[model samples]
Target chain A: MKYIIIASLSSLILQSYLTTILKIDTIFYPLFLIVNLIVLYKYFNKDNLKFIIYALTMGFISETISSNTIFLQPILFLLISFIVIYISNRIEVGNINLFLIVPFIITIYRILSYFILNNIVHISITNQLLYQSIYSSIVINILYAYTLNYIFKFISNKYKFSMYD
Target chain B: MKKIKVNPRYLILSILIIIVVILSFISYAIKSGRQLSPVESLIKDTVLTTQKILMAPVNFVSNSFKEYQEKQDVYKKYKELQKKESLFDLQEAKLKEQQTQIEKLNELLTLEKTLSDYTYQHAQTLNRNLNYWNNEISIDKGTSNGIEVDMAVITNQGLIGKVVSVSTFTSRVRLLTSSDIHNKVSVKIKTDKEDIYGILSSYDKENNVLIIEGISSNKIIEKDSVVVTTGMGSIFPSGVLVGKVESYELDNFGLAYIVKVTPTVDYDDITHVTVLKRLK
Candidate 1:
């Protein structure tokens, strides 16, 4: 419940309000996707599945509500969360190796989600898939690897999972 | 031997996934022109109301910064506007005279009112869509504010899009930049010779221009020709500005001309819009 409340409030602030004020929401990457992935990576565990599920859904509610159809973001985010959990179990966080691995996972996820939405709903030309994925990957590399963590930590302590250690 | 038992957490996760998948399909299948449920409208209105509160401080600071920037050159712009204002006054008089003349002529001919007869409602954009794939946006107007689905939405610059979904206190608009095949606009390109009509079909995202395809006329079209909604489909009101023609070329078999038009509205940064509701 605590995590869901925090996640919902921050999602509204970051995804809806701040991006509009800064005017970087367009011609740039989806910031919410990167943020959700990082949050899941930092705190993935077996104890509380509801936190992970609701965190992704509430954080991504802006997408689902604004879309003509619902549940695309939750469906995509849930599938990705499961895979991230599987990966998190085997990996050690002390090595900072996720800096290298997360972007790659995100890129594949981006392409797959874009493919699904394009085929199922957006229905534009198939040619834009490659271009959009490449563009998102570059933006994600810069944003996730460097700055968003600090900006996120400023907003809430939920990302305070491993900052001190 | 110990029994191989799956953790109940995984079981819960799997069940949740299956439920969401079923919901996704149901939503997608029946997504065509359905009214929002009471729960959906309640959630949407709550978010929109909060966004309005959050945007207040942001808008204030941004406006202050803008005011400071404009203050430096205020006098220069004031002089420039003074010169233009006199010219505009003359044109305003002519326009009003022509409008009254048009009203008299229409009354004589017993013709019904048209594109000019629309009533507009102002609404502020609460938030943009979370992804770039769909150029949909949520506005602060809905059925409670007399906004309906399929009503044409526009900014001061030109036509932006049409309302797609409406709840009690919030509505969603799908911008013209959306890549959906069904998102076509009938547009009229005014040239020196005559106005040519075509369907505004695809969007050229790379170049930031809209492609108006399916024009059957071979008549030569000039560059920078004005484009507006033809109002033929009845969804969009007539004469709403769409864009200006940038260039044109023949298709592979030369059957029709594909014209590229630059949209007037910056789809990236929309703050407010007006919904044109034709009075019944």
Candidate 2:
């Protein structure tokens, strides 16, 4: 419940800043995608699938408010969350090295999502900003995920928040 | 009473499915011109009002920065204008005489009857779409302010687009740059010989130009000739400036000549526009 509240608030702030302040959402899409996934990963439990659904629902609400498309982001977020969960289950528990592959995973997700939206909805997703978002997100999120993982680990250790350590 | 136990995964999946289905239906219905439900209207009003409040301070700071820059450049611009003041006066007088002559000719031809009288209502842009597919902007005026869908929107320079949807407090303007086939506008090309008519078709996203299609090949169109709305359709007023011709070419099918035009209004710099209401 606490993690859900914090993540929801963070989602709102990130969305507000993206739409209202920068006024350009696609330019920083990779960062948004990765950050949401990281939050879900940090707190997800297989038995309690409600956490994944809650995070996606929060993302859907934010994207619907801030973006032009109504159904694209939420569905895409749900799909990506399942992929991440499936991959993480196979990997060693609390393996930090898995973070290194996140950028590449995000890029693939971006392309697949773009393609799906373009073909299914007949939307024009050919903006150069889409490509820029993919490349920049990959480069930026690698560093971003590392920093976030460090902070989460430090906090977890100090507070003894979970059984990971 | 018997207690019912619900599985969490099944419950969450069902909820997700319900949300997506309801949202999709509402979105489609709204696009199809159904009146908004009271709840939807309230949500829209609250969100738009909040956006307006948050944007106010940011707009003030940016406007102040721009004002300072303008103040710094004013003296230099004034000095340059002083040199051309006499030349402009002479040209203005000549243009006034020509306008009188054109008006007299228009009266003779009874063309004034076809020209609609337009009342302009200025509106501020609240937000712009960040996607490539939908070239739209939300303005801070709506039905309460007398703005209606299909009303033409223009800047000081020329036409920007037309209103597509309206709420009680805000309206959406679909820009001319959108590649949708339904966005075509009937436009006339002003040339030395005579005016030629064509439909303003899809905008070229890569070249940043407007495409005027279905023009006859026999008409000799000069480069840089002006294009303006022909007013054939009831939606847009006639004689509104659209753009100037860039180049003419034979399309791949060779059915009709295609003329590329550069629009008059700078899409990048547009902040405010006037929604035109035709006086009956």
Candidate 3:
């Protein structure tokens, strides 16, 4: 639990640096959620309730940080995170292909969100910035997954298994 | 006989996830129907502020460098003036022509002040993207400094480009040389006084040149003729120096001319630009 908090804070700091210092556009929310899940998976013996809560929390925070509509973010996060945890639990953890599912889900959400926002709300996504953001997020996700797997392995080796590590 | 039971936890988790996803979609639909909240405006302001803070040092350094370059030019001019003094009266007359050019520039500055009421924020260019794909540059000012989208960006030499995106502290200016197919400029031939409309076709990589196509072949255009903005679509102010014609040749159609131009602003050494406040 302490490790997850530390990792979340570190992710925020890294995101701030990437955005301000490096002048690179990157989404830190997905990374924050992924880190928390990895920590939960390694420390605790896969409690579905806790996993659902974590996913929901992650979804809420990610949406909030991304400046998505407030009321919708928590609801969306809870839903997506729950689905991810359910599907993830059914699959073998060692399979790298399972990681691709996160970004795939995010892409679907983004596309759907775009349509919903445009058609219903009348909020348009300018083509240029949208393309740039999507491209940047994809690259960030790929890097995050690679680094996350190693971090999870290290935590699993170092810490004694507990209900809430 | 002991029977294996299904994990109720998995079923509950799956159900919860499905519920959340459904709610999220519903929320998205509802949020889309409503007007944007003040929170979004606040976030935009915060992001712009952050961008401005990051861009300050970069702008300062570029501006200082530009000042140094201008000083060097003045010193070079001084030396040339001294040399002309030692020559015959004819050389002195050439120096007077240079003086008249400066006076003419001063008059244009006065005219600029009278015609436009928009306040301009001056910025220095730190970096420019000259790649075949994107023609953009990082300027020293952003939204925090009142720079906004559709703002006309210009240098002392002529019109540079328009502001595309603004962060809090930094902004991206799309250059006239951008390879994006949608970039179109209404240009006028300074010599013939005729309109030549076209898109920025390509950049001459080997020669560091820009190509402007879709010109009428029948027009008596020549190399070294000046090109300025026509202010047709009102994207830019008229009379902003765009470039000078470098080359012109008939395309296969023989109906329009393929004109190549060298941009007036040394895009390679762009340091400062003035953002026009009120863009019509």
DockQ computed for model 2 against the true two-chain complex using alpha carbons: 0.15
TM-score against native, each model: 0.83, 0.74, 0.46
Q: Which window of ten consecutive residues has the lowest lDDT sum in model 2 chain A?
A: A21-30
lDDT of 2 by residue, A27-113 (tens): 343245445575447555553377467646754554433343555566666767777776667774243664556765676667766
What docking grade does candidate 2 earn? incorrect
Residues B188-214 of candidate 2 have per-residue lDDT tens digits of 999998999999987776677999999
How do the residues B1-280 of candidate 1 rate in per-residue lDDT, one tens digit apiece? 8999999999999998987686657346434545667776787778778777867887899889989999999999999999999899889999999999998999998988765568889998877764445477888888999998889999999999988889888898888988756679999999999989999997887788999988885677899999999887778888899999998999998888999999998877888899999755
Q: Where is model 3 chain B poorest over a 10-residue stretch in terms of lDDT? A: B126-135
Report how far off residue A37 is in candidate 1 (Å). Answer: 4.6
Q: Model 3, range B226-261, lDDT digits (tens) per residue?
A: 887766555666667878889888889889888888
Residue B249 in candidate 1 has what lDDT? 93
True contacts kept of 3: 0.04
Task: Pull out the clashing pairs in model 3.
Answer: A1-A165, A79-B20, A79-B21, A121-B32, B48-B168, B49-B168, B51-B169, B52-B168, B52-B169, B125-B271
Pairs in clash, predicted candidate 2 = none
Off by over 4 Å in 1: A1-4, A24-30, A40-45, A93-95, A125-165, B1-33, B131-134
Q: What residue runs in model 2 are displaced by over 4 Å at the alpha carbon?
A: A1-70, A84-113, A124-165, B1-37, B91-116, B130-134, B265-270
